[model samples]
Target: MAIAGALIWAAVIGTLIYATRERRRVQSEHAAGLLILWGGAIIPALLLGLLLGYALWLMPDIRPWSAPGEPAGLRIEVEGEQFWWRVRYHPADGPPVDAANEIRLPVGERVEFTLTSSDVIHSFWIPVLGGKMDMIPGRTNRLTLRAAKTGTYRGPCTEFCGTSHALMAFSVVVMEPDAFRDWLADEARPSPGAGAPGGELFIANGCPACHTVRGTEATGAVGPDLSHVGSRETLAAGIMPVDVEAIASFISKPDAIKPGAQMPAFGMLPEADIAAIAAYLEGLK
Candidate 1:
């Protein structure tokens, strides 16, 4: 457009010069110059308008209501704690499966999320696939999203929750529907040879006073619910992997991993008790 405008301007100047030398009528020269100037200005304006319109059309429209054909059958609960996301998957007839720092969803299914906060305000965001929603205490917000394709999507806290908010992040795993079901089934099983021992220690060590595990005696809700801890990918508010070593480290020293974490350090536990507690949590699939 700029090039066209410049060419038209040059042509008008050249025509005026020629008309002056050849003694052409003033009206004819004036009409030609006006036509060129108007054309030059109008063309670019039209092109710019078209470009902006196209961009607006391409952007996704987020409505307060869910979109058509979007998955509504799958519901997940996400609880924000300090700087981490505690995820829970609702099964058809049983208790919800608990996880931290990672969320798993079936590919090609519309998944709805119920967002809440244990303490402060936080935001949940997955940039590549969906919008951001707030996790407010004593209130629940809903966000519905579907993965058209299968892959891992990274998300982070969109709100400034606390000192370690910068490190708050979670992953969305979109798997085949059948695979997701299998994973859930696996997570439902008690940890082989260690679940009972761990459950006993969890209560004896005072973990049950704050955390809750439905269908069990640990009914405390002061912290993130742990009914399905084994299913989670990471722990400590997304600070470490949900593995034996990471659980041990978090149980031993939480402040070291997350400075402002509300959970106190249990470093005084004997190495054997710590191992037993870690083993029990690992069984909460």
Candidate 2:
């Protein structure tokens, strides 16, 4: 795609350059003949037509979302929320695992990403990967990605969906097959109960009303899952690092850290209570 786009821009610029030169030059009768017209116009027309045709023909092979035996591979459902991402990993032989903000994938595996949106239109894009796909409400878009190397990559929303669009980002980690399998198993397992007021704080704060924490009483349907919040690489959809300080700042003044965030600030709480809440959330990993 990059090569094709560069070629197209070059053709346009070249046309403008030739036109400028013609305008400044002394035109003879021979310069305006049928042969000059053919060389200057018809030849370029035919070349552009062939170039576009070739690009179209290569599209199927470049992004084959429906490759054979794709069903046997890993399936992940990602929902673009107000300003975050809710991810579900479905392994080949186990129940789905819930996660948010961060994603993990195996190196050299063609994982099928089933994308959707909870509200408005969004776009999923990973620059190092292939292309971006639309995330439409009530509809699913599919994209396949196979990493050629093991590393961490960032993915940002290519579409402007809302006020906090700038902060709506996620991270992807590509690991070796064995490492990924182990991580997947660990992530898929249910989270252990945090016990006591730590659990109480999550509930008394009305967290369960919007988030879900496995192996606990907190079950909220409106926000992203908090079953493994501490394990994520970043918080507030990559706006801040996943640390106690960041979590505390987010809990106190969410919109300050991330403008236009949907989560309200907790400045009304005492400092000690806020620290306890942040500690509890950061200990989930």
Candidate 3:
């Protein structure tokens, strides 16, 4: 498109220079009418029509949907919250795997995403994959994409949703098919830290009321799943590095770190208990 525009600009300049030449003859009314009719109107109309037609031809490839009665091989449901993301992976042959903040895909596989919002509107965007899709409250949207590369990419909330919109981002990890399958299988199981000392403290402090860690008694639905949070590349929806200190800081003062976050602050908790909980959560990986 840029090349086309530049070529048209050059043609216009060439014409202008020719018309303004000192030895140029004044064209007849008939010649002027023909120039206006073709160059001014018909040529531009043809160019725009061609561009529109080309875009229409590419729409299906860009946003292809599955055929009726044909289920997607892998469907991921992602719910957008005020300042975070809730992710659930549904494989064709396995149970749903709940995750948060980070998304993983296998190279060369077409994955379908079911997007929605819990509070306000948000836009799910991964520029390397394709265009952005909106996640609207009370409405579901589907976006299909295929990853051809193996690397880590970043996706952010393109639509302004709230105070922490800028902080709401996720990491996309594209891996080889075999590695992805192994990772997904491991992700489907309970966290390794489910029964550690920190896990006990996590339960004692009413953390289970909002978070869930499989293979243990900490099962709550108000917040993102922490079953494998330690395995994720980033913390707090990609705002902080995935480390014990970052986890402890967010746990102690979520509201201070992310304004408008729904999770209440736990800064008043004992420092030892907080550190233990962070260590336990980190061990989940």
Candidate 4:
């Protein structure tokens, strides 16, 4: 179309020049006719450009992998925090798996995400696959995305949450349906008990003031609900991994892992206590 438009424009210009050269007796009329012709052509092109731009702006995001019905495979809760993201995968047929920094979705299946925040406002965005949705405290926002291709996509917090906001990022892994099911099954199995010291320290110290565990007495909601913390992929709001060592270090000093994080450091605890806490959290998966 652009090539055709260029050719037509060239023809119009050539016609104007030819009329100017051939019609000396009616030069004024020829010039007026040329002006009118050019004006008429230019107006429509400008209007078409404007319309196309407007359409692009107003178009809803297109995710090629999404099936055209309610998502049937998985529902994940993504909570944005200052400088990080918390990911929770709720299996359609099994229990939820909690993690930080990473999200997994089944290829060719629709996945729904419910976004929320623990503190200030944030926006969730995955550019290649979906649109941005705000995560406001005390309220939930919904976003749906599907990965037509089996590869990793990077996502970040489009809304500035805090100082370390630039570090707020996560990855979505789109895998085959069977592989995703296997991963969920593995995450569901309980971890062996080896984190008793950490569990005891979690209670002895004041970590339960702002977190929660569904089956336990620690039921605080001021922070990200930690009922399934061990199963999560990231922590400190997608700022760090949810592994035993990372959990231990984060509990020892959250500020070190995520600057300006609201969680206070518990480095004063003995190494054994921190390890125990990390072990217990790892078992939550």
Q: Which candidate ranks first by TM-score, i.e. highest?
A: 3
Which tens-of-lDDT digit does each residue in 113-166 have in candidate 2?
A: 899998999999888877899899999998878888999899998899988898
* lDDT for model 3: 0.91
What are the Cα lDDT values of the candidates? 0.77, 0.82, 0.91, 0.73
Ranking by lDDT: 3, 2, 1, 4
Task: Give me the overall lDDT of model 1.
Answer: 0.77
Please identify model 1 stretches exceeding 4 Å from their true place: 1-71, 90-98, 185-196, 213-216, 283-285
Model 4 lDDT, full chain set: 0.73
Q: How close to the true structure is residue 49 of candidate 2, measured as C-alpha lDDT?
A: 91
Alpha-carbon TM-score of each model against the true structure = 0.71, 0.80, 0.89, 0.64
Candidate 3 residues 13-86, lDDT tens each? Answer: 99999888997578899999999999999999999999999999977755757678976678899999988999
Better of 1 and 3 by TM-score: 3
Tell me the spans in candidate 4 whose CA falls farther than 4 Å from its real position: 1-73, 90-100, 193-198, 206-235, 240-248, 275-285
> Model 4, 100: alpha-carbon shift in Å?
4.1
Q: Taking the tens digit of each residue's C-alpha lDDT, what string does model 1 give over 1-285?
A: 578568868977986777679655566778877866775677668867887886677444333355588544768889988867777789765667765678888887767788999889999998877879999999999887877888877888989988889778887778999999988776555334334666787888898898876556787867776767766666665556788777888899888888787889999999888987887787776
User: Top lDDT: which candidate number?
Assistant: 3
Which is superior by lDDT, 1 or 3? 3
- What is residue 245's positional error in candidate 3, in angstroms? 1.7
Instruction: List where candidate 3 sits over 4 angstroms from the true fold.
Output: 5-31, 68-71
